[model samples]
Target: MTVIDFTAFIGRLATASGETILPFFRTSLSVDNKSSNDFDPVTEADRAAEAVMRRLIKSNFPQHGIVGEEFGNEREDADYVWVLDPIDGTKSFIAGFPIWGTLIALLHKGTPVFGMMHQPYIGERFSGDNGSAHYSGPSGERRLSVRRCASVKEATVFTTSPLLMNPDDRARFGRIENAARLSRYGGDCYSYCMLAAGHLDLVVETELKPYDIAGLIPIITGAGGVVTTWDGKPAQSGGRIIAAGDPRVHEAAMKLLNA
Candidate 1:
């Protein structure tokens, strides 16, 4: 089936996952550390939301594959795969921040064909299909577009936290942060969506999984922006990602990042 046919189903997945997660937001939720060496937090909301989405996908498209952050992979070799990060910003969620969102991506033969970031708390949904993007929520619905920004000196950039990056990556990112007109942190998936919506200029991140980035690639590209690795590779596999609203800015940032 075509990607268009999956749009409604994606909406359903977003809704179901959002509903499953909202109640846990800002509550006295128990968190589990998924990493022994680091603070990789996962809560019941993350697992429950993913479980709901997984069940829906399994029942609706039994033949499709699934890759999730909370759970392990299943049928990963199938032609159609769904990548999910039920709470893309679990850190923010745990901090009682509304910046977290549910990330859903559909891969056609390993290429992202559809993506959406749904924030139920803020009631915002950002969706795309590589060719175009749209935003819907309390502010109403509109087409998503990136604003023009030609240079890092004139740009606003964001990253979840430089602390998340290792020493070398952090040093490279510091170059961009120092050059940019503004720098902020702690958005996770919401920062990428804001870049898609013309509100931001650049987003640079490192140490991301497929589930962390697969859903964001189409949204940024579809909104007339660019997303890629620091060395200019596709970002679906998710490592050292850099996204910018303008190609010139992207090129400029890439040079700085690689230098």
Candidate 2:
């Protein structure tokens, strides 16, 4: 197959998602519970956003497959797939926190080659494909690259919600934080945006589905960052993820994880 122009498609998709998500930012959404815990919440906004994106994809790229957080999978055997995390921070969106956003990524043969993280509430879109990462905001487009946070002790660590982790996962993350300079919470896919923007160093988390990590791959890789499972393996298959600015930092953290 010819090289698909991912940058253009992702940018258009991001803009389309913005149109669907912006009005509902704080305008009273129909929120729902995904489980007994309020921390695992969902909203009509999530479904509606995914629906909007799915329609766009089906109309324009009918041959492509889609795996969406809300809608499950469609056409899994297609040569290319789109993974969509519509409103990744659903808990934040339900709580009116404005920290939520949509994540979109294109996978070619189970590998991410393009990604977009669109924060409609904040009017920011971070995207990359074809070996380039850029952010579109009020200041126009700016190139992005990960910062060289040389060591774990000097690195910034981000995990969206510690409450989402089990005891074993929490302990694993704690062992990591105990060696880090700073640890902060909030932002789901948006945290990866921070990493790609060079404003953050590392992101570690567990129990991620494909949609959760797919959208960060291209942006992170394009920014000259490393993203993988804790064992320093490919993240596209989805599991525990650790994204770092430096390869050395990644290896050191992986050692701690496997230890």
> Considering every candidate listed, which one attains the maximal TM-score?
1
Error of 1 at 152 (Å): 0.7
lDDT of 1 by residue, 1-259 (tens): 8999999999999999999999999899999999989999999999999999999999999999999998999999999999999999888899998989999999999999999999999899999999999999998999999999989999999999999999999999999999999999989999999999999999999999999999999999999999999999999999889999999999999999989
User: Per the 3 Å backbone cut-off, how many clashing residue pairs does candidate 2 have?
Assistant: 0
State candidate 2's TM-score. Answer: 0.94
TM-score of every candidate relative to the true structure: 0.99, 0.94
lDDT of each: 0.95, 0.84
Worst 10 residues of 1 by lDDT: 88-97
Best-matching candidate per lDDT: 1
- Residue 100, candidate 2: Cα error in Å is 1.7
Clashing pairs in 1: none
Residues 168-216, candidate 2: write the lDDT tens digits: 8888888778998999998888888898889888899888999988888
User: Residue 66 deviation, candidate 2, in Å?
Assistant: 0.8
